[model samples]
Target: MMTTPARIRVAIQIPPSRADYAAIRRAAAQADALGADAIFNWDHFFPLGKDTSGKHFECWTMLGAWAESTSHAAIGALVSCVAYRNPDLLADMARTVDHVSDGRLILGLGAGFREWEAKEYGFEFGSPAQRVQQLGEALHRIERRMTLLNPGPVRKLPILVAADGAKALRLVARYADIWQTFAEDDAFSEKSRLLDSYCDQLQRDPATIERAVFVDGDPWTVGTRLRERGAGMFTLMTRGPDFNLDGLRRWLAWRDEHNAQASRS
Candidate 1:
């Protein structure tokens, strides 16, 4: 059996964009009070839920705001679109945010999706294959620029890339410090196996790539199982006007239970 790590944490994905700043603020403050490890907002022009142009906050800007509000808990975009900003600019922004957060920033990134959002912003909504191709290149440029930046990052920004595709996994192996995946589905086990296979095929130590999965379903049912399948961290995504603070609290309780159980073993 695998030994449990000492710092098991629960994260809350804060959806500030779709909700009011006051509401998002309340959620962030509450989640921090409730002892969440990290908080995030998705990078997008419009809301992914009910409203399109609703009172949505921008990703980096909101993350900066979140940084100021909460003393504890890491803050980041759930997955920033590498396609939106130039790699150097994105690196600088991430670096700046990292400093602002006092090294509590996670640079979660992925290729641009949502063609409508891109077109509205005048960003090229390229084909899926092209986007994936660009994602790898973007990561390379970002890393290079991060090294060349004036102060360097306050801390090595944890590069969190999403998905379990072969190229995605390879990129994760090559550059990412954290591999984020949506292991909430029924087929999560199969995808987890594929992630391991990719690591093996790339000759990268699977343990080096910290698994960061988005939590779905019952925390009690899925929490420990996810850790067993290779997830080192699980982010609970709470969407809407409420932002589900209660749900995150329950999930935190589950994380504590899982950690306690693992410790006893």
Candidate 2:
């Protein structure tokens, strides 16, 4: 039961798969200019779905570029895999990006689930429980590193945890400023209730954690329903080739209307 905001904010995830670096950069900049609250990219080494071997750029590298290119929207990985890099190094990279963006960066992290990525990169794939445990340790190390780094982060960088499992939810309760997941209908409601229970047990005010979810389909029909289900941040995924903004435009319009109503109230 997080404190609901009057207007729902929207993020757009521009997948780097099968697209040129120039196209990806343009899409991110355009999304920011079009009033996106955040612009995100995934942490996979290869393209997801259809063309697994397609041209795909690295996540953190693109984020660095986005930091300098976008003027308004916060930029980050939709969720970076904890297994991919050393926690301390990840923290430093995030800190640098924060500086580059002038403090507009969200550090989104998760226990990675891609076996191919680990296998190809020579990193340990590990079991789900093991990865979750690693993620917890990584979170602790990241926090410590953020403090130890010279000059430190531009601000107390906001951490977004992407998780749905019970163990991961506990970590989210303990550390996350924003909790993100992809669920809908009854499953979405149930997961949210479980998160609230975790917050209560941890003596945390649920309102302190912002709720986010990935959205597909029409904003007016689907987005409103998700907002009602306690998702304040809605993220839409746009794949490359031609990073479409038509849908994003419609959602931004919805956001504007919703916020205006809130102001009146």
Candidate 3:
């Protein structure tokens, strides 16, 4: 397991919907230049908002573009559905992107929740428990395939598992380098404690897995409280056509201040 990262990191998830590819590309590049620690796009075939028919793009292909467009920030899908693609194929694609980004890649995975996408795409949208089981199997294959790839990853590519339930968190404890959660406030703290227990059961240091939270609204307000509850990575989400990055700037400033204070302490 990797040591705890030094500073609080801020990331942006630029939704790949309702905007042109150019606009999305520009926003990603700008966010990277402005010092976002990571940049992300979600994996979904359709629009998540009210408008069912809206512009959208695939995940990994856009990540490949992000690899060329953004030089600094790590790029990835916020959480790719393991069921959508074959595990070995996905691992190979990730390895390719890791090389494209010169190792600035974080492979985020989830059991997958969107049944509509699965049905439309002709995938087996199994029950929640079944999907979790599938995810565990795929993760094992992904890890094994990564080792077998000819060029391999540029580094031991970090695995960020977005999990909220006990079953999923168990997978996280065994496989993840970072654990991303959507639970907040008291719920967030409770889940953190639960994850700690899982790590203990596995004889893994809880500190080895960095905590990430996906948040909206005032970054400082959300981030400040979560920071105390073991969140070291904060992800702010923005949707296009106007991918407003004003919030990202504020979060970056707060991260800088927090890191500086930690260093001084």
How does residue 98 of candidate 3 score in lDDT? 98
Error of 2 at 133 (Å): 0.3
**Across residues 9-50, which tens digit of lDDT does each residue of candidate 2 receive?**
899999978889999889998999999999999899899886
What RMSD, rounded to one decimal, does every model reach?
2.2, 1.1, 2.0
TM-score of each: 0.91, 0.97, 0.97
Candidate 2 achieves a global lDDT of: 0.90
Per-residue lDDT of 1-265 in model 1, one digit per residue for the tens? 1222444678878776666789888888888889898888889888886568777778888888887898889888879998999988999999998888788899989987799889998999888788888999999999999999999898778898986677777788788878787655446656656666677777876677677777777887777677666667888878767787777878888888878876887
Clash pairs of candidate 2? 3-207
Off by over 4 Å in 2: 1-3
Q: Runs in model 3 with CA error above 4 Å?
A: 1-6
Q: Ten consecutive residues with minimal summed lDDT in candidate 3?
A: 1-10
Q: What is the lDDT of candidate 1?
A: 0.80
Q: Which of the predicted structures, 2 or 3, would earn the higher lDDT when compared with the native?
A: 3
Model 1 spans with C-alpha error above 4 angstroms: 1-7
lDDT of every model, 2 decimals: 0.80, 0.90, 0.91
